[model samples]
Target: MFKFWYANQQNRVRWANSFSAEYRLECGVRQGGLSSPALFNLYMNNLIDELSRTGIGCHIDGVCINNISYADDMVLLSPSVRALRKLIDVCESYAATHGLKYNATKSELMVFKAGSKTYNTIPPVMLCGRPLNRVTNFKYLGHWVSDDLKDNADIERERRSLAVRCGMLAHRFTRCTTQVKVTLFKAYCQSFYTCSLWVNFTQRAYSGLRTQYNNTFRVLMGMPRFCSASGMFADADVDSFSTIMRKRSASMLRRFRDSPNTILGTLAERWDSPILGRWIRLHAVK
Candidate 1:
């Protein structure tokens, strides 16, 4: 762990007129630095500890998860609406004590199982003395998360976005060679698959993405949209989008297995039987 030393804390900048301005950055980590995330995690350690003591987060098989934090972004979890309110209260108190504040306008409430009768009667939640706006869908970590936990909406949105990006790429790289165009697509558009980690990808969604993938390659290679491109793909030695998704999913599963104590790991263990089903028994030696 990098120690937060006085010497390392010094930050200064020069803006206009050859003049220099210096100020003590007494809070938060440096933006865009390699070690910033680690430093921020260290800074948030105390807050996490405090929240853990509250016993207000989601509890599964005796393990409690009050919240998840990635750098400064946070998602507080609770089993009940009342408990969620308390959790937010604790969060607000912690922030106040730590010289931090919530962006109430940006903060929102999303009730899961929103169609349940219990949710209809639940009171509104407030943060920073203002009611949190209730939303049916919100984007988290660049993926749309809906109240129903369905991926179709998110997948359609991503498809449209990918189409728009491919259109722009086609317009800008009209003179570029096929190889160069493929390279650009790999660099810029591959993340569309990479970022879709938690989506429950339906067959329709997969087909749509695959269609887009094939069309993008076809456009780049100056081939008709209906033309077969198996030879082109073989020549480029690029994996299909489906293959990439499988590889990424397997990699993610391995990571989940490694994270034995995390919520994801716990869920993975709980669902192992259902996930593997009779396949595990079928593959096992007698």
Candidate 2:
């Protein structure tokens, strides 16, 4: 049945109103198909197994996590440059034998350290015989990951995004009903993207986001700048920024705890085991 579903697939290109002749697909799964992601995961299972057997990555409580992946995007983790290079080599060999290719240009190397020191002393990372770009920061899974592992840059970016969304909502929906405006605010302005991962941010940095959040409600309600917004949030049944972040972090922890994924669950439990841990310390349940 599976083979029948994927057999003899035909596709056509639509240019404006004109349609090109249909061509039968000789290889690969259908683009945007419902089963594509699952099929891709099955295809990559062997590669994941091989990498796991290499045992060259961050080790926690006897468990090794060499890579973090979501579909095609992957981040390789290792304690040292040499170990990371070995992981890359293994991946390259697997890809070469499997008729796959790596985009060396899109690949980047980032060295995480304790302090605000420069990474110039660290060795370069090579992929497929080409040097990958070394970056101080990179966006992964909708969040900014910095070399220093600080969340200030990511928080500031989220604040700017929220500010733009607030302005957009106000400009376009000023005449809408209060209830409608509130709905729009919740849909667009209320999202603190990846706030659950904000374990290393300054209070002042987050306070800025809270201020912007309050201003969003003020703009939506047409309240004066100096007017007290003390009970306004509660009155509108909207959670405060801090409360929202806390809830998101708690939700993330719950998902990790409930997930059946062995690798991810092990990693999360290891992090949560410590009293002053990452996911646990910030939103620890009493």
Candidate 3:
């Protein structure tokens, strides 16, 4: 009977989950996921504990160049294959300590500095499903993510997120009267002012809320006067805006604006009073 709603969407959302016993294999540039750190840490911690239980001889946080060495990844130096074997025993024992097991399939062991006068063979094992013979780059955390990759990912992630936010505004954000959603919109607007270079992040956020509430509160509630510009907090660029006096912190003001709590946590901060002048002076000292 209802043509518009029925034609527009389905009543249920069918989700496909990954729980199949059969392996699924696809290869491309495997980008690091957002939750990779927490996941990798859990996996590594298990392996480390397992190796320790087997009476291993590896250092906990290995350091070669004093301060230059990073976390977790270790470099073991030995003269002979026998020494490397001993190191492997240590690794297995360590694994057993934490109720974990590390078979060869999931581990990659590589021998470096082989048959050299100055440097003996250095063997290192990669934790994340690396091939013993074929593995070229090391896995730091869950990614083969290097500093260069991180720099690219940082910018790329930010840009893609902006696009996603724009897409959300383009599609899903149709319904309203959600106090929680309204609060989120208000919070983002109050935190940072984004304008162009990426879906006009700050401006788009404001424009979005207004567009959704075009019927009732758009023109009225969404004003720079009543609604402070996020730039008032983000770019503060005090030199750029000389009109704002050293009255209150831009962040404090922003927080107050976002949160519905009218009664400030402190009695002095609750209301605008002469004591606020003294409070401001105290803040300046610190």
Candidate 4:
């Protein structure tokens, strides 16, 4: 049945209102197909298993946590530079054997260390015959990840997004009715989706975010810039900034506790760890 569905798949391109001749797909699945990610996962399972057998990446209590994968986005984690290079070598070999290739230009290497000029001293990691860029921070899956592993960059990103949304709302929807404005505000503005994962950010950064969140509602409602936001959220029937973060983080903790995967569940067990403990203390359900 699978062969019948996948065999002799043909595709064509449409450009300038003209149709090109269909060509047989010699390899790879259809892009954006529902099963593409699953098929890709199946194809990459052998590489994952090989990496596991090597036992060269980060591990926690006898569990191999060398990699984090989501569809095609994969992040390799290792405690030391040597182990990381080995993991990259293994990935390169597997990609060659499987007819897959890594784009060295898009790839970046970041080392997590405190006050160390590691990038200057360490040799570059090569992929596809090109060296990967060494970066202090990079965006992954919509969140900014830094070598310091702090949440400040992501928070600043969210704050900037909020400011842009606020200006859009004020300019585009100034004459909108209160009900319409409220609806649009909730849809466009209250998007602190990654707040639950914020742990290592400073108080000032969070306060700035709160200021922006309040300003968004104020501008949408045509209220004074310095007006108190104490009653604004209640009047708008929307969640407050603190409430949003608290609720999301609580849900995250619950998921961690109830996750079927033992490694994920271990995150909840380590609630007292420096990272998780700060999150729990600041946002856990009272």
Candidate 5:
């Protein structure tokens, strides 16, 4: 897929008042001086190239559940654990060749259902969060299996977007030479101070649950939640900081055609190469 930097990482908040910058910058393209949005696709493409000669389509394998492949979490429809294990082998091999590590604990598999369709979902990871759910967040191919009541995640996202804009605006005003009383306002006005409260409240709750009520997390909170809190929200509950999966869409995988992270482009190429497909199926897929 044509992966773009997420909104959070794709920030254009003016950092310097002395120099008016573009309020909005499209990331992924190499631009001089701007480094907020790391061009992660460059690295992913390298991995794709390595796997293409291996003769594996990775996820193009068939998944059947209730007789339909369309699912909020279609990846979970692999029929049995053996199939999932095969998928994992493909993943490990891909990681090994690309000089990357797949954190298995975080790189787990979960199954969810909406109506009759099954979904496969991946929550966010620690340290460096991936966009498994958002354009900026690490979404597996930028999509996941989610349920109907999960609208709260979008609400949380809106709250976070507000905070980023407000934080940037507050910082801009504080640094502007033309803006009078910069010092006075910095010391007195708590304008930007409270902007992240919503972000914090949800984050704190997630943290609290992570340590004590992890098992009963959903029951305790009485609802499913996702964190879009900027770095401001630290120590969140396990899945609180993820974009849960939703109905699968071809559009979601459309970006895969050009993204650096395509398992198909890499593995399929390798599979098409003579001898590699036999090697993997005989040795790796055992």
Candidate 6:
């Protein structure tokens, strides 16, 4: 396997001079290539498997989930601070053995329920003998995740971002047709609100988001702020904001249900009661 990987990697070259000086890559996968992510995942799988054998991950319904990874980003979870530290040690050791190094500056430690008063009790975590900074909230994959898992802060941030984008769009596309404006709104503005897969929208949160959506449509249609948005929505032939969010949530749940033996599937199974109950309620209402 090592020989094959090295052989395939030898073809990678970069020019050091305008025409003649070429250097061959002897190690590390190429960045931004389509195959790089898969290759990296294959290399990291061994380390993850080793960690799994140590049984130091979060356990739920007899299933152990130590980490969730997508491409190179990973989120590690443990039930206790000691176990989390051990996992970090294992990761550092594995990286050293594999000719890789962890960027301690980019790493952060967060303890759930470790509020301001009790946060000091949680011990420090070190990478390369340097302590990692602790944070009360962190952004992961475009979503703001807080210790309490509340969506208020994240929602407000997204709302402001969307508002700015809408203003820019309206300014630049003033001469665009109504249909074109609608298309752009759906493509650009809607994605910011819908991309957060883990958001559990409460009534208040949904209402706020709905208002933003209406204001966006009103701006696109050149309608007065006080006018009813329903007419513009009907002209655009787009579903209501709540309906779109509900469909997205339901689609995500269905995908989780259909996936078997994976991390998400295991989570869905463990939370079967609430997930299934929601599904039933949704269908009944339909």
**Model 6 per-residue lDDT at 230:** 70
TM-scores, all candidates, are 0.80, 0.89, 0.29, 0.89, 0.28, 0.83
**Residue-by-residue lDDT tens digits, candidate 1, 113-226:** 744433655688889999989887898776787777667767777788888888988889989987788888788667665332434447797678778877887776687878
Candidate 4 lDDT at 47 equals: 82
Of 1 and 5, which scores higher on TM-score? Answer: 1
Give per-residue CA lDDT, model 3, range 169-213, as digits (tens): 434444544444444444332222221111112445444443333
Clashing pairs in 1: none
**Mind giving the per-residue lDDT tens digits that candidate 6 earns over 1-286?**
8557656553434467445444556677777778787888898998888778778888877778898777678888998888988888888889999888888899888877743434555677788888988887898877788776557767877778878888988889989997898888888777655332534447686567679888987887688998866776777787766556567667767788798756777766664555455554555666
> Which pairs clash in model 6?
none
**TM-score, cand. 4:** 0.89
Model 4 lowest lDDT segment of ten = 113-122
- What's model 6's overall lDDT? 0.75
Candidate ordering by TM-score (highest first): 2, 4, 6, 1, 3, 5
| Candidate 4: regions farther than 4 A off | 1-4, 12-27, 115-120, 283-286
Worst 10 contiguous positions by lDDT, candidate 5: 63-72
Which of 3 and 5 is the better model by lDDT?
3
lDDT of 4 by residue, 124-162 (tens): 778888987888899999999988878999999999999
**Better model by lDDT, 4 or 5?**
4
Candidate 3 least-lDDT 10 residues: 191-200
lDDT of each: 0.73, 0.83, 0.38, 0.83, 0.35, 0.75
Candidate 3 has an lDDT of: 0.38
